[model samples]
Target: MTAVWRKSPQDFGDALNIRETVFVKEQGFANEFDETDKTCDHLILYDGEKAVGCARIFPDGEAGWHIGRVAVLPEYRGKGLGARLLCEAEKRVLELGGKMLCLSAQMQAEGFYKKLGYRTVSEPYLDEHCPHVRMEKIL
Candidate 1:
């Protein structure tokens, strides 16, 4: 039950693997990996030696930070790993002097983000063929 969060190059690979399994192969987001990852900071969550979840954060001009590509292995869902990854991402954003955080949450995940204090800022829209809504949280 010990989970660790950290920044590392390996996180990119681990995150991509999870995204591919959940978003691409399963959900069919053909272009899931985009240019944003090039300039953003990624956080990885490990349950013992297994990578269970990950999230990425980037500067959103001066408005604050933008979080993206958050995912957890299917078998790992409902265990709070996603929330833990988000908490770690928010901490990293705050460490960088950010005052707010935003994300385009998949419609199905809006409730989960809401529980984490994120408020919807827009109506649902299509993102990669899936319904998504913009959400934000003020730090």
Candidate 2:
């Protein structure tokens, strides 16, 4: 395992690169980026200056903070980088005065989020071809 650093990137294109690798090319998603990328709080995980993982969080109006687009490069998975990135995002939400966080998690990765204290809040649904469920955790 390698030591990692987290940054609130001035350029979210760094986040996009990881998301594109995990959520787009590897996952076969056509529409990956969205307008929300322009406004959300974006985080990137770095291993000695190389961006390896990322996530984004923001308020959801009536719902609270929503966390999404979390991705870690294939070579960097299983090293606890994902968990560290998410925990940092949770901390970021609290810093932004949020008491809760919600996310739409791909069913295959649902267990990973659950281990971090997120609970499924919605039945499985399809995002394109992938099945996902809504989950939440209170801060």
lDDT of 1 at 37: 68
Question: Clash pairs of candidate 2?
Answer: none
TM of each candidate vs. truth: 0.91, 0.91
Question: Least accurate stretch of 10 residues (summed lDDT) in model 2?
Answer: 1-10
User: RMSD, each candidate, Å?
Assistant: 1.9, 2.6
Query: Residue by residue across 72-111, what tens digits does model 2's lDDT show?
Result: 9999899898899789988878887888999999999999
Per-candidate Cα lDDT values, in order, are: 0.84, 0.85
- As a whole number from 0 to 100, the lDDT of residue 14 in candidate 2 is 74
Clashes of each: 0, 0
lDDT of 1 by residue, 5-58 (tens): 445555467777778898888788889887776667877777787777878888
Error of 2 at 106 (Å): 0.3
